[model samples]
Target: MTARRSTFTALVTLLTFAGILVAPQASAASLVEVTAFGDNPGGMRMHVYVPDSRPASPAMVVAMHGCGGSGPGFYSGSEFASLADRHGFIVIYPSAQQEAGFGKCFDTWSDAAKRRGGGSDPVSIVSMVTYAQQRYGGDPGRVFATGSSSGGMMTNEMLALYPDVFKAGAAFMGVPFGCFANAADYPPGASRCTGNGGANRTPQQWGDLVRQAYPGYTGTRPRMQLWHGTADTLVPYSLLREEIEQWTDVFGLSQTPTSTDTPRAGWNRSRYGDEVEAYSIQGAGHSLPSSGMAAAALEFFGITGTPDPDPPVPGTCSVKPTVNAWNNGLTASLAITNNGTATINMWSLAFTLASGQTITSGWNATYAPSTGQVTARNAGYNGTIPPGRSVDIGFQATHTGNAAAPSSFVLNSTACSTG
Candidate 1:
């Protein structure tokens, strides 16, 4: 709900290397702090994560933190980082310094923050996006935004002000752009403006405000995906409708939903053409991003992952493999034993996957060439194996048919005894 991940205590351990431009730490994990990315009028901090195994020109997402939340905190809390790891995309987590009653927050209410290139939090955010594009060679057309609560409000703001910059956005429990006006009244009047006052405005008026942010801008407006709980009291649930109103109008689409259905049992979803989609979670007040929401959001962004196979298959496998099979997916774990007389350092286990199996992601060890003849290498921390010791590696993959173990295995070029 409120401060969804703001209470994470181990953010420092997760973030450690701030103000340093280092290489990707592991196969699929690295969070680096970039100081001079670009103009940062909002005085926000930038933390970027680029998975070791990713596309050459990866898609990018700006993940803003809620009030009282830090970039590293949200990175640890939200599933976007893991999804980024799976899809090989870049994530820009910006820490907001401005206070929004609860804690640190992106400037959603400020006049400067609301307008396009008006020079505030939104400007700082765009600077981060630009830096990601320039530094990481990110795909410009696939840039996106998603955040929770106040950060979610910034998500809406980014889409509204810089439609050219983002292809789409997902706002979890957020308000409409420009709805947080009346800075003099602040949080006291926040309820009034977002609740009774702002919710009453016609859809046209709300849409006009977004249009005015970047006046005369004639480009494809980024699509929107909004999530809100029915019983939210902090930022009333009614603003969900208000956000739908604003974006629908901005896209010149009808307010009447084109389709409505339950994405999950208690979660109702309404789609307005392809421009906007809103999810209302029943009885879930202010609480957001409930489990698989991040995955759904990334799917909406068209960042589908791939196994993209490794190489040609080889001989008999030499590892003890245990598998958990499901309908179309399976999880496999393989234990490799080092029975050599001497201690071995820096191990690479190579195995040929079964036919029709494609890996999505793996842990403990880094797997390359996700399918076919693949190689699993130890991470930075697990590079050594004493004699008579074993190291376990695992992967999750999608299978069209049989979920079998690797046909052959080779550990650092020496074929071991078959299991």
Candidate 2:
């Protein structure tokens, strides 16, 4: 047997000896199995946990398992369910169908699983998200995915394939999206992408892979949290860099991190403008996130001990947009008027820019995320507006071809008329 397999076995045995291992079937006691959740194209099973306390629109998390693991098994081994009980959110544990006795593994290597609406594990997982939304009034805007090893790979896949669904994800010991391509020989299969393959792609090359996963996708990409061990042998330790490169490029961040610090002793973290964050556990092994990870992941997902932001009420504002267009770019202006009864101390205008359209610079307000669902917050000079008064903010955005106007104007949680 290869040393990696031997080490994997030894780690599993050690976790089992430490009472961290639980049988897949035994997890059913805590998580209710949901068969016929969808067409089951991936042949995966679904299990869910609903806390007694729930918000009117509680958030939902899809907690996936690694190879040789089942949904309930992960549900038991992971802290998400207990966190759900405390936080009033729901958790879904998905169990992949055992493949050729190789162990139950989510399909991150298959073409069917890589693309959008391709009808495989990914489609099945989306169906589960839809099921949760329809059945439990789950907040569509707050869905998230997380996993370890194989499941971690799927977390990257989920964000890439369905950014419209997931706001963010935390992937543990995961490789870059499409890292398994051309390498079906993993874990006994001789592959170049894992275990000393030496992650050779440039950041743009890796970003192209993620963009290709869902062609023509122009939405604001979901954020990512990456965790990996420095001493991993099953998956190459260098993959953490590849994953970082891929996602930072997607979020339009430079390779250099905005901040670097140690969250805890022995755990080094680098954050790329909050769009991508990588945590390196020094001297750790395969399958990272030893403990106290779920809470941190939840924090990244904005699910603090409290619930999600309350749904906004009917808007009492107006947005007037004017644009000066060129062949490759445009300068757009917005007039935000306050129609509320009281004076506004602070204001933020939220809108969605077309795909490929990125804000290069702006005046009168601060723009964030350049593209996708963007927030233009008032600068210090324009933070206050009296009733019946208007604030003018303009930004210059670059676009390759599509120069359509931004839409879905929301000012401080109030819907605004885009007149």
Candidate 3:
């Protein structure tokens, strides 16, 4: 390990042993796992992070990851840990079912998952927040959810389904309001124009539905952060602009931003009274770079603006990326550090592997190989990583074709470019 990682490891070990005795002195941050109630027996696991002294300190952001993502990766790479510590707030990430093969993906268009209170979907997420409030002390006044791609689509669904619960939503690379209908109408792969099913709605129609969804909320239209990359290929870029115009038309937002600034990356930010904001990153692609956009979300959470100098990358989660030729497998261990400003209550990790490797695991968890990827389950380490602290995970794998250890790494939830 590098000097910095070693130091972080030592500090995290100390804090883990300290438990709740120290109380974090300043704004405390830790990751905890809570069970979200649904109709099913294995409900769903949610990773939560909160400040030391809560109730009214800072708000919370329900950070949702994209397709095949895990709560732990979101907590680690998004820079939420450091941001929570600095701004004195909380961040929560909930896992989606892997029955679809990918780890944490929302079945946004599933007919069975969308029935009124029938599916183990939206209700499950709301149950998670309620659990946080009851056990971890979450603020009801200011609660929100932000997501990327599929996760972002879920954010829109949350706004539509649980309008009374969430204060606002931040969507990045997500489809517009009624985009789900496209998938549902086509039953599989339906482009925007093709899906004219009864479920589908135009952008304006979605805005109208959202307006009616929240009847009593006479307050300023719920705060929101809209983000998109001009180069986003998965979710059409034009949809973002259209969503912004439609949302503003329905909500009556100011024509321009309250404050405009560029903290990092090529992202141009537009803020509105700490309630609403948007970022249009220039030349960016797909998901937010875990470091930049995640930190941006933290700032939007009203956390302090001290950026993590060396935030953990997705690649840093494991250590000693190695391949076992004898067993025809590849393996590595990972360390998760809390580089954000708050505490993480719980976390889970998920990643896809290139073809040729089938994971047979050895660590704190087991490996389930499917669709050219490995899903490892690690539990019971609810250790708190103070700002800039690190935690580690170890794994060993078996290879099929020409499998080799990963050349890249992630530490404490952030993504590293190289081994």
Best by lDDT: 2
List all candidate RMSDs to the true structure: 15.2, 21.0, 12.2
- Candidate 3 structure quality by residue, lDDT tens digits, 10-86: 88789879773322222245576654332332265677777665446357778877777778767765656665665
Candidate 1, lDDT over the whole model: 0.79
What shift in Å separates residue 122 of candidate 1 from its native position after superposition? 0.6
Stretches of candidate 1 above 4 Å error?
Answer: 1-28, 188-190, 305-419
lDDT score, residue 364, model 1?
Answer: 83
lDDT of 2 at 86: 77
lDDT of 1 by residue, 270-364 (tens): 99998899999765555466456777788778887322222111232247889999998999988877776654454567678889999999988
TM-scores, all models, native as reference? 0.67, 0.65, 0.58
> TM-score of predicted model 1?
0.67
lDDT of candidate 2 over 89-140, digit per residue (tens): 8898999884723687888877788778887899999988988888778999
Residue 394 in model 2: lDDT: 93
lDDT per model vs. reference: 0.79, 0.80, 0.58
User: 379, model 2: CA deviation in Å?
Assistant: 52
Once fitted onto the true fold, the runs of candidate 3 whose alpha carbons sit more than 4 angstroms away are 1-30, 36-42, 51-58, 98-104, 111-119, 182-190, 193-203, 212-220, 254-265, 270-276, 305-419
Strongest candidate by TM-score: 1
